[model samples]
Target: MNAASPASPLLEVRGLRMHFPVSEGLLGRKVGDVKAVDGIDFTVRRGETLGLVGESGCGKTTTGRCVLRLEKPTAGQIIFDGVDIASLGGKQLQALRQRIQVIFQDPYSSLNPRMTIGQIIAEPMFVHGIEPNATKRMERVHELLTICGLNAGFADRYPHEMSGGQRQRVGIARALAMNPEFIVCDEPVSALDVSIQAQVVNLLEDLREKFGLTYLFIAHDLSVVRHLCQRVAVMYLGHIVEMADSDTLFDNPQHPYTRALLAAVPVPDPDVEQGREFRPVKGEVPSPMNPPSGCVFHPRCPMAVDRCSKEAPQPREIAPGHMVACSEVKITG
Candidate 1:
């Protein structure tokens, strides 16, 4: 799949599906499948941060994994820089790893406790056949550590010796070691202290500008996504229900699901917040093994009609760049 054009998105996922089969019986015959990422589509433009936000188990993380080819999509096209990566194998796939990277959610378990910080960061460079010389690798490790706001001398320290925030910085350093053009930041700040979260977010923003990198920032924290992303895409039960620019989406959310999510956010002003309405999202998320027919969110959606429960809504542009998948949405200025 050649890139559609020079102005095409850096990463494009079309109809991506990842289904893990569930088997039961003496022979463990296939009985069901966990539809982790069920036919989702989105894109990340060059040098842009696209936020993927959703409740737990809504496939936000799974989508990120599919893009990185960590979890092979059962179906769909994962086009990176105009090449269809989902079909690549051997050296082709191996080479693609250097251009795309991931920073895991948990820093404690992500790094090897036995390895020193320098070795941890240099591992990717070595695997990619980059910075092969031992002396040069050490120098590059120090430079990456410094760039990620860690002390250069801490290269000799083990994972057990670092704080949570520090460990995350090392994780970031490792991801940067490959000099990737795109990164999957999978809740990179969720495990840190509130104060530390801000620092890490700021650092990511700075690094994006410095490296000219694009990011698929997956997180449940709306405020954090608002702070970091230029555009936001809301996922529900393996489908993107709404997508729009940060300011436009926040100010004028059209989908009922999107409205429900934004309504749950806490406002800072006591008096104004007290007067504002709060509509708790109704019903627990449905099981992905056998998700509801039609719109997955219709069961929990307050505004769902008979049609919503019978037919799936296709994405349609309501404004310049705002797209909503709910048929109930009425476009108005």
Candidate 2:
């Protein structure tokens, strides 16, 4: 499944957009569109984790869904392993699924309460015609459970019989059953306790190494993103405002939104924390349905200039791999 080389990234998304049409009346005449994801682009290199981070409503989840083909895009290409999957259909798309999978955010709601854990994990294998025999599928299920750090005996139990962390692990086991090359980890650790969160993050890192899996890790937790991702992309109102290696992005955030977000990450040092003057971004996140013209983030950006409200800034590579979409920040490559 790892059919990628240095010549190309495992996942390359260009101008991807997902807009939910707004309608009026029972006839459903389209009046407007909710621009959940609007013209965003990035690439997830093979064996690397690219974090898609933003506030809750900034369309990071929608972008992940579009990449997985759970939601079809309005425009643009979702190229996976040298093929554009956004346009695939029928058997072509079905076959392509073997190389891609998703681990959802809510473990409880994602799993079926009616099905036993063994059946749940084995369903994907059976659907994809992986393990044909019942006994073999069960064995594979048990093995997957073990790989996800769950006991083999737990496979016989229902999702309700497990805790939040266990259920999330089961979800991971399900995704892994496909031997996927890329997995969209949509806030996989967000629902767990702080201690459990660390365990899950570590498990994902281990699996990535073990499988050479690529990830589009979507989350709002900057700390968690810093912990797990190699590269990070910051999104605001459906646009990637800035992107860089995790260390570079955290150490030297170039966008106003990015700086505001880092300012919010709590510091453990009481002396530093007490003395720090954090200025949270001003104004509420504007409605995506009626987003402001020019720069979408200008309404909340403290350093916004008159030009920021009049023209959108194009994304520029400020330094090697570091890209920022802002006109105000002056820098030299």
Candidate number achieving the greatest TM-score relative to the actual structure: 2
The digit string of per-residue lDDT tens for model 2 on 240-308 reads 999999999999999989999999888879999999997777778988899898999988888888999
Clashes of each: 1, 0
Compose the digit string of candidate 1's lDDT tens values, residues 1-333: 453443469988899998999999999999999998888788888889999999998899999988888887899999898888987888898899999999998999999999999999999888888987999999999999999999999999999999999999999999999999999999999999999999999999999999988999999999999989999999998889999999888889899888999999997799989899887988899999999999999999988999988999998888878989999998764
- Model 2: clashing residue pairs? none
Show model 1 residue runs off by greater than 4 Å: 1-7
Model 1's C-alpha root-mean-square deviation from the true structure amounts to 1.7
- Output the TM-score of candidate 2: 0.97
Every candidate's lDDT: 0.91, 0.92
Task: Give the Cα error of residue 303 in candidate 1, in Å.
Answer: 0.8
